[model samples]
Target: MTVAALAEVADVSAVEDRHVRLAGVTRVFGRPGTPKSVHALGPIDLDLRRGEFFSVVGPSGCGKSTLLDVLAGLSKPTEGTAEFEGRPIDGVPAGVGVVFQEDASFPWLTVADNVAFGLRRAGVDAAEIARRVDYAVGFMGLKAFAGAYPAQLSGGMRQRVCIARTLVMQPRLILLDEPFGALDQQTRLLMGDELLRLWRETSATVLLITHALDEAAMLSDRVGVMSARPGVFIDVVETGWEVERDSRIVSHHRFGDITGRLWEKLRTESLKHLRDG
Candidate 1:
């Protein structure tokens, strides 16, 4: 199908499935009509189906993070619209969670307390908050370390805690900004498996931004590749992997081919940026 036709279908599906939708979204920094101004992103069109894991990949400075910021309502698009569940997202929308690359865990608080923080802030009752904290901590495999401080945990464990905090809120949509970027290769692969399990269990629509080609292919049902600055999605590739996918997804016959195609598009953009400079 044509790009416009696909987008039109996406809009129709968004209304019925309560998906996240972005139409002609653009983000610009600095003043318009000035040399200092930077057009960082868009006129990008995207639609994320409910319970689907979508990942965005591109070269550095390609506005991958900017796209996530706009979706999370952390920043508004300079032009166009971003909507969640058919409602325009003016600010941080309800039923959404975000996990950044940096450690978000509180040093002083134990894992359980850290997970419970959001519930407490939202005025969730004490008993329900306790219930959710227990569930999330256990689900993220932090049950044994529920009372342990952040400093005592390994990098992977600490990241799990951050994820648990987001999970406790039971968000319908999750935004991850290079959540595994800080980890070693082995740790990142292990965390990828854990994230896949969590995604399956929660059935939350996920939008992840990452520079890792393998990570994106392994974790996403559909992967969108963006251009270099003034980033717009140049193409979207479907992995065609089953929902049971994990780190071992690299073993799949088509994995290499899919990653190669993504790299072809992404590499050209990165080189273009260098040549232009």
Candidate 2:
């Protein structure tokens, strides 16, 4: 076959793997071109493949959350399009779950209750809700605390509860926005191990937004770094790590090199954010 044919075949294969696509997307907080309008994101093209972990890293106020919102169908782009599984995203696309940075757990609900909330709301059978909640609680290591309320748990545990809540939905695509941002560095690393395990077991596509370059390097298959507000991807660094790898791989000889690449791109954008702010 000719080289052009080979390239076309490769491109076709890539197209088949995509689970989400953002084309020429741009988001503005207010009216377009108005003095008060904040052009937050886009003209950015992004693609996420089935069962891959993709992380977005950018300086503060660079609209990292805005990008995720577009994917979640919570916010419409001022220009361009956002699609999931080959269709335009329309109001929280089916089989998609999101875990935000804030502690979203309800203090009034027990761990088991919180995990089962979504299932119940969807009118799932009581038995099915119990079964799925059981698995999610165990998977998140919250089985022992199943009866405890959010206020009684540690910050990390509460985050795990939030994750479990999302997990019980059996979502095919998981959007995580700094889910462990409130935890200590050590706790964050340990939580990354849990996330890795969850991804391995579920085979769900993951898109994480994080400020910690090391955390992005530790968890993602590829990391995209964005510029300051009016954010656009400045670089995307592929980790080439195996899907089964965990946070322990942070000590691997190549880990530093991978993080170095992310920092190199992120550093300039971060400085720009500070200056603009």
Candidate 3:
């Protein structure tokens, strides 16, 4: 499908119970009066529904990371607004969790302590922090290794530890920026299944930024494709995958079709970025 057509569908489908809303949001960097200034991301309009799994796929350097940062309140938009649960996001909004491409685990801390770190910082009662930590550790299948440090775990297990830390915070929105990019393909797929299981168990609205087309198709209910730098959301493709989706979804016939459609839009923008550079 064409970008325009996909955007039209998105507009028509957007409803009232939005968990996150970005309206005409844009981000720019460099000195305002300088010729070197760069416009990094949108004047984009997008809505994420409560508990929805939304993935974003785009070419490298298409400002996908910038978009994720804006959503996480790590960076501010130069124009327009980013709202979370009906309030404007000013700075590090509460109940929002972010997982990056790098391993965020603190090697000095045990898995259970790491998961409880955020809660402890917030001055949550000791008993409540322990309870949440225990629940999150079990949820991520790290109960067996709760006392282990990050260095003792495999790459996938470390990522799970990172996720468990975020989960203990009970975030209403979770932002993942290429969280599996460092793993091997097999491990990446396994982590995807694990993520799906976690998503199903929580009420968090997830926004994942990934370059892997198949990963996006397998995990997302709707995938947004972005244009080259000064990035704008060009299209939103529906994967039509059920909420109970898993790695088995790669075997579904429609998976290829959705990924292909996303690539069609992404390829053009990617080439455009290369040429402009």
- Among these predictions, the greatest TM-score belongs to 2
Off by over 4 Å in 3: 1-16
Question: What's the lDDT for all of these models?
Answer: 0.92, 0.93, 0.91
TM-score, each model?
A: 0.93, 0.95, 0.92
Q: Write the per-residue lDDT of candidate 1 for residues 34-128, one digit (tens) a residue.
A: 99999999999998989999999998888999999998899999999999998999899999999998999999998899999999999999999
The true-versus-predicted C-alpha distance at residue 239 of model 2, in Å, is 0.5
Report how far residue 80 has shifted in candidate 1, in Å.
0.3
Backbone clashes counted, model 3? 0
Candidate 2: tens digits of C-alpha lDDT, residues 1-277? 9999999999988887999999999999889888999899988999899999999999999899999999999998999989898899989898999999999998989999999999998999999999999999999999999999999999999999999999999999999999989999999999999999999999999999998888999999999999988899989999999878888888997899989988888888888878877
For candidate 3, lDDT tens digit of each residue in 1-277? 9999999888766644688999999888986557998988888899899999999998888889998888888899988999998899999999899999999999999999999999999999999998999999998899999999999999899999999999999898999999999999999998999889888888689999998999999999999999988788889998887787799889889988998899999999989978987
Candidate 2 residue pairs in clash (backbone atoms < 3 Å): 25-43
Superposed model 2: Cα runs more than 4 Å off: 1-13
